[model samples]
Target chain A: MTRDSTPGSLRVLVAKVGLDGHDRGVKVVARLLRDAGIEVIYTGLFQTPETVAAAAVDEDVDVVGLSMLSGAHMTLAPLVVKAIRDRGSDIPVVLGGIVPSQDVEELAAGGIAAVLGPGAPADQVVEVVRKVAASRS
Target chain B: MIPRHNGGVNSPRQQWQKAFDESRLREGPFQTLSGIPLEPVYGPDDGEYPGQYPYARGPYASMYRSKLWTMRMFAGFGTAIDTNRRFKEIIKAGGDGLSTAFDMPTLLGLDSDDPMALGEVGRCGVAIDTLADMRDLFADIDLGRITTSMTINSPAAVMLAMFVAQAETAGVPRANLGGTLQNDILKEYQAQKEFVFPPRQSMRLVRDTVAFTAAEMPRWHSISISGYHIREAGSTAAEELAFTLANGFAYVELARQAGLPVDSFAPRLSFFFNAHIDFFEEIAKYRAARRIWARWLKDRYGATSERSMQLRFHTQTAGVSLTAQQPEVNIVRTAIEALAGVLGGTQSLHTNSMDEALALPTEKAARIALRTQQVIAYETNVAHVADPLGGSHFVEALTDEMERRAEEIFAKIDEMGRGSILEGCITGIEENWFQGRIADSAYELEQNFNRGERIVVGVNRFLEGNDDDDLAILKITNEDEAKQKQRLSKVRSDRNDAAVRDALDRLAKDAVDSEVNLMPALIDASLAYVTVGEMMNTMAGVFGRHVEVPTI
Candidate 1:
């Protein structure tokens, strides 16, 4: 709504990438981003990679922030990445919430930008989104 | 004696006191967890004689001396038969009541063979897809004698019907049946994302149960207006209390609309709450919740009876507080939390097993969890008195503070309009409110622990290693799914197909129409061996799905 036409800042999508409903952190991050003047599209709970990817292409979002607390990060993240890549969007994707430190490297190897775990504050999320958005530009 | 006497108009000190009238300043967030200002110290007269409402000084005068709270340990995993074995084990361990947890598929009213239930059958809990599985869930467990509480909601009516049908077949009369159904669907909209029907239709089913129970299952709770899932969904104690009670009112409103007398159903209404690790905060939350509900039921709703005002509740220890790191530490956390629930006056409780963070509780871990409760009941004198922290200045103030803050949330929900809370919940605002508070508290605690200001034994101080030895976890048997599927298929093929079709058709009609209680129809369908999945599939087609847009 604002005159700022920045792509990443314009369309931010928040998703619970898998089965986990522990959205406390995700909700907080969404609020912080919204307050920071970003458009947030939330894709509810229990979203598989296909639905999430289709949504990414549909919404034309600049980033896909997948939240996983179910320890299914490995199984879900790669599928989402592959689906996004197959869509040929070249969208920069970021992950958050309860993905373990070890899986961060693994997810990065598979082309997920990064996975933010617990204690990563709202400010840090905004910073990462801004950086990812700027780099995309 | 040089006693400092007051000087008024001219004295500098007196002028400073007058500067209170002249003082030009305003400040910030006025509530504290303990309801205290930044007052460095406390003395005699801050607050006292803060009598508990709804008989809070103790619900009943004699308290535990007259009645001990029911030891209701929660259990469910693998197949219904497997869970039944655990139920027997729990009963043998002196569990006074039963609380069964259904698996994801069962909770969502899906059969084990449904595509969505593929690998998830009996994953989080026991699978109960039909009357056969429900029968197996309570095969030897005496339902007539012991009270049972099912944690399944969306398909609760179907499950209850199956339970009742099984019981009657076992020669247990419907009149003698006793238990509670956690039928609070509002929490489903916000916290637990498990609802087959839309909110309005869900309330209708709940109303039917409320009405049905008043006639048939007199001892059964029509609904346990729950704050547990809200807390688990990252709401604070106050938010949980407020939102949960707001939901209670919403249900009462629907029941009233359904033409049931307020007192007829209000007496059967119960509540479920979560007792987290914040010792005093949890206690105050409970005490405050009782007071608030009692007041709202009488003053706000114009209910006349004492039973209508009383807020009876069951509690479960916090499952979210457990850490996969040094999982044994969870036992201590559960103990303290269980004590909080006890001290707070929970009518019944479900303590989490230590290994629940990783997998379902192993039999050994479940036994230990039950033993933790046993120790509190028999060894520790914590339960010997009721409302032990009732009159403490800090506790009382906290109760008041929680009450005040919760009222604000309730007001906000009301302002958004009753139906609007569900949509508001979908929007990031309400979740943001919940997440903001939790995030702030969690961050403060993390920062404190990291800075060595607040010690958390193993994590930040007195660091230890190798907690695996402390856990003897119950592993899930892969055979559970196959066994459940086999039994479910038999029920599907062996029943009166015409009856099931008729019931499902009627349920669809009621759902399509204006708000209609679908419980009776649902029960009828269950009687005809309509699988949980089949029933939900009917509704899912009509109501459509609600997407809880991600928050942060």
Candidate 2:
């Protein structure tokens, strides 16, 4: 509805994927993004690939961020991206939470634009998405 | 009398304070942990009698005088058999109830052999992939005599059935069994993501429990609306109470919509909240929860029964707050939190073990946690009095302020809309930076603690380099998973192949059809010995899998 039109105008949709049931971190990121002048619509938790993709398309969002602290990310994230791709929409899906260092490459290869680790600062998150969003344009 | 100014930009804060005659600040950020104005005086009118408005005092008239809160030490790790052994031990230590915590795979509704369940079958809590697992989980415990609480969310209905079936197998009639299931799915989405089905679908399962349990298992608390995870995720006491109660309202609304009588089922609806480090704030939260829930059930939901109004909750000390550094300090922290849960009038409580930050608790540590509860129950005279802080000016003022703060958050959730709590909008409220700031503050303040500016007795100030010397962690011993897989494989192999095929086909058909409860077919499939992952996979085939929307 509104845009700051700064060099980096970020939009984030923080979500919980799979059956982990931990969304507190995602909630924190959403708040941090809003304060930073970004449009954030969290899809809540237990989002199916179909619903997540539908929201991404319906909202016309640039960045789709998934929050999965559960080890199910490797399995769940790919399905979400495939759902997006199946719809013929090209959007970068970033992930955050208790991601092991070893799993980062696999997640990225699975079409995750990026993976932010546990100790990621709110500012770094903003910066990463801003760059990713700007590149999409 | 001076006029009171509501906490808004319209009225100046000074005028409001003048009206209340509340006093100066303590602790950083210019407020008490409860965010109430602290006065340096005492008076008679500060708190109401026990069971009065604001519930800052307490709910029950006698409080702990008549009966102590159920001491539920939430313990379980490894496979079902191992946890079964551990449960007996916990009971022997004078613990009163069983509170189960399922492992990742079980929480995910996957059987142990599922490829997705690799390396994480029994890490966090007991793994129960099938009815057989549930039977072993409680092998010898008399299900009818002792109450059990399961900390499960997404697949709670299925597990509840497994529990019911287990009790049946134990010869305890379904109606006779009593316990709680943490069927708080909104929290599952809002905080914990260990969910199976999509929101609307999962809500259906929730409806099934509230509907089925209302008629069958009268003693079962079908859903424990949870704020425990919210607080553990770094929410303030006020947010914890407000969001949790809102979710509770959402559930009540769902059950009513599902055609279940409001009073009939609402009575069995329970709450689970977190007892955090802030003592007065926590106490005020529990107090406010009772008042708010009672009022809402009567006014909004048309709940006529008093049983429907009473917001009975279980409390656990904040797990995220436990520190890894000089971990013994967690004991004192847990003791204070447990006391807060007590003062807050928890119906049941789980105190965290000291070694929680490092790993699953050692026996010595878990015993210490149970003993902590016992010491409070027996040795301390605190249990004798009802609402010990009933008349403190600070606590009363805090109770009011905290309630007001939560109402504001609730108002925001209302602005977005209400209903399934799945409206894709509740997520926005959590993201409102509403609860997020707490974590930012805690993480920031932790630096001060590290730098010795903020003093924590054993962690930062005290120096003990040899603290790590030969500290033995409780390691899970035994091939429970292997044995479990072997049994499951044989069971699958030996079952009538055609019947299994027909049952699955029927289950898939039931799932694809719109508005079907699917519980009947699900229970049938279980009766036919369908694996957890296979049944869930069948549903996943029909419902399709949940996709993750990226957060920018």
Candidate 3:
């Protein structure tokens, strides 16, 4: 309830899609956004794109951040983005993990609003999320 | 105690002392990165010495002098044929053993051709759908001579069945087949979320595999109780040690409850740990693990054999510690972590390649990672002596602290289950207790790094220009995925469909009875050329799937 007090708190849904179990980055980002006075909902590991997109609509979050370390991003990112689109929510989806540099353009083309690779600072991530959420709003 | 002074013009220590008086160090007392306090110097009375019942010193009397730790780089990617060629190359490069990293599909018990496995077939690791792939995986390599370690958990039993079937077809007796299965399903719930079945049912499969290996595959390590993934998932060293040992204890209890003698199967049990960047902390954690495991096995479990009390573990340099910013610095980070593992007495070590933070290791990077171990083994004198830092007051104190914290954690976990480890772990997992703790630690660390209180060299502290263009990363193409699909299709068509169906039916029938150990049926299915996915699907029908309780 306290999260609603801050103006433009930018409710964000952090989702882990596919069988990739690496959630350290996503959990860290969730805490970071929550600390920055943003409303955060974390969908725990092993989530399907359908489930993630449905949760985004049901929760009506302003933004969605998807984290995956397994190279299933190409296959999974599109599904989640399309699912959110099909649900008629223009929520910006941010991606993070150990993504290769070459895959950046392709992932961005697949509707990833921002791509944060490994070692991206928390402040930079927050700034990107805030900027994207503002644009969406 | 007074500082020692040498009667020279000026000793290096004396110069530093004078400079400290003239200038200043940090504002106050110095501590380890993990917040362990540091005294100016160390002497006796820190803790017990290495060797003996609680083996803080080392597992064996002659640690590396008798035999150096096996250099087993975790390598697998693309199709089985591709990985098999890499295996031969590694053997030719003088690797002592093999460590297999299966692809996401194979790891999660999905066929290569499954719709869920699109674009993930040969990306992370090698794709092995059936016995035919396993046959190609170890094609030219002699199974009797080279011991292999597989990093698979949920479907470990099926993979082991396939391995056994492959070896049998190759005329290698089960007695001669030696390898380790990372069959640590508990950690799957705790940290690495690659699990399929529910917790209690997953325990059944783990128990069945451990029981079967204790009897039939005596030479094989039934399960490698892994703390590596736990630490990588952002647990502190103490949590990693305590949680891993608790899981180990639970497995031991489960096996004993299944009517197996402790000593008979305990010796075959092994451990796997992560060598994080905290050099002294990692060393102390390993030492404390050995001592705690030895004492627990002896006193708690009433183990008389020394072999049963010894804790043998494989170590891998922490991939989480690697940086994508200045990838070259990862080489130094991995070497330091590898050194810590060696000093801490790992039975085998896998140093991560520098490029792993970006992509799967390129051949040159993997080779350099292997050479890092060779340099440590031959050039460095650290291996000549066992527990070389055994008597250091700092190390001993840290080791004692680690053991103390682990005991506290054990007490909490025990309390959770009403003194039953198996029950407590199940409750702890279901309650998201472990996940909560790890998330807290990870969040704290991230906050520290973000605030510049904790510094990662290339990432936060030292700024460097862009120069990663020359770094060649290994890429798996759509062709690789298509080839793997074709291979799986061929295996499906080549095998006798009726025989495979019958074997799977028998497996499904046997799986319902708690009294039946499922390994024999699994092996039968494997021999009948039942795919890994088919075997797991039959069991999943009985066991059901695992859905995690959200923590954050």
Candidate 4:
């Protein structure tokens, strides 16, 4: 997808990808990215992987950010990555929330561009997304 | 000036002030996180005694002197059997009460084998699809002898029905079984988002449970109006107090509207709060909460009984405050928060495990968390005094400030509903008023931490030599989900389909009328082995599912 908005500005899609209703983290991240000059689209709670992938493709965003706090990150994140890939798109996905350190390597090797755990600082989150978006672009 | 002396020697206050003026103080805002200003030292203040009306000092005259707060650790994972083993361990390890955590699928009223329940069954808590699971959950445990608190809402009525049926089958009379049901559905919309039906329909369900429990089970606490999720969702301490008490009032109105006497059901209502990391502010919040609840129950709701006016609550150390980085430091954080809960006079408490920020607490972590509470209760000598911080000038001032701010919020909500707290809560949930305020507070706190104005020990300021890679966390494998599916399938196949259909039909028909109490029908359904999903679906078919008006 070509740059649809400002030439250098990145568009990131943040979402809550499971039955977990804890959206405080995702909503805060959306604001942080927005304040950092990134155009962001947030898919609210109870979103399935298929729905999130379809939204990412439909919005034509530079990156997809999935927030899974319900310990379903291991199972749901991979499905989301595969769903995005099967949709004929290679939008890099960044995973965040209460993911254990042991699962970080597996998630990265399973097509996730970045994995941010709980207490990840705003700068780290923003820089990770920018780096991934730049690499994909 | 002839050796001016306020007293025989220099007065203690004057001497302290002289020393304080000479000592160089650090640059500071010198206020609580909730923005209440604090004084370096407190003076005498005339405060009410413990066990009085309004109960500002403490709810009971003796407080912990009479009995220590129950160390109710919230335990659940994998399946009912897995959680049952944990419950047995807790009871053996000096725990007096059991608190159950349901998995995401069970919490949302979905069967384990449902497509929507994929990857979620038995992950966060125990998965209960039928009364069989409930019975297995308490297999060797005696229901009449021990009390269990189930942290399940939205589908709480069904869970209660299953519990009642399980107890009766085990030869325990319904009246003898004691426990608490977290039937506070209003907060689900405002913060937790685990709701199934719309606001009005959910209130009807809550009303039904209140009426049912009041008439039958005298030992059961009908609704535990909660603010823990609200605070965890990122509200200020005052918002948690205001919103939770407002919700308590709404439940009272619902019960009164159902033609039940205020004293009959009001005494059974309880509360749950979050004891956050702010030491003095959390204590002040708890104090203010009791005062507000007692006064509102007596003056606003017109309750004559003291039991009806008393605001008894369970406190859980804040889960959101734990950090994944430097996980061990969370023990210290939990200790401080638990102390605040104790000093604030909570009836029961749950401390967060050190590794909770990363995953569901492992066995060792949960045991240490329980030990933290034990040390406070046994070693600290904090329990010897009731409302230990009662007369401190700073604490008294903060308590007043919390009450003032909460009353302002209540006034706004009252205006929104034109007087009824129940209607006000419905309006607040509908318009996303509560959601927006909570989100704003969460954003501000994040921004503060991001800018280095706030110092989180591991995350922001002290970022050296912290390694969590070696920390062994609990991993819920997919095997549990597969096994849970098999159990659910077997139950579905073995149960009489005709009987299940009949029970569900009766529940659906009874649920259509607002005046009808659905608990009896729910108990009948549980006896017939109708699954949670079947009962919820039957009711949802009548009430329809609630989709939130998204607020970002």
Question: How large is the interface RMSD of each prediction?
Answer: 5.2, 6.6, 3.2, 3.8
TM-score for each predicted model, relative to the true structure: 0.79, 0.74, 0.91, 0.92
Tens digits of per-residue lDDT, candidate 3, B412-438, equal 999999988888898999998998898
Tell me the spans in candidate 4 whose CA falls farther than 4 Å from its real position. Answer: A1-8, B1-47
Better structure of 1 and 3 per TM-score:
3
**lDDT (Cα, tens digit) per residue for candidate 4, span B1-552:** 243344423443344445445545534444555666655433332335566678887776556655789999999999999999999999999999999999999999999999989999999999999999998899999999999999999999999999999999999999997889999999999899998988899889999999989999999999999999999999999999999999999999988998998999999999999999999999999999989999998999899998998899999999999998889999999999999999999999999999999899999999999999999987766676668798888999999999999999999999999999989999999999999999999999999998899899988777786763478889889999999999999999999999998998899899988789999999999999999999999999999999875555
- CA lDDT, candidate 3, residue A6: 47
What is the per-residue lDDT of model 2 for residues B260-356, given as tens digits with 9 covering 90 to 100?
8899899898888898887898888887788788887888788887678777889999886676556677899999999998877788899999877
- Fnat, model 1, is 0.25
RMSD of 3: 9.2
Assess the local accuracy of residue A96 in candidate 4 as a C-alpha lDDT between 0 and 100.
92
The candidate maximizing DockQ is: 3
Candidate 1's residue-wise lDDT over B218-318, tens digit each?
Answer: 88887988889888777768878887887888777777777877888898888899988889999889888888888888877778877887788888999
Whole-model lDDT values for every prediction? 0.72, 0.72, 0.86, 0.89
True contacts kept of each: 0.25, 0.14, 0.68, 0.67
lDDT of 2 at B502: 89
Cα lDDT tens digits, model 2, A98-132, are 55555679888899888886545567888888877
> Native-vs-model 2 lDDT?
0.72
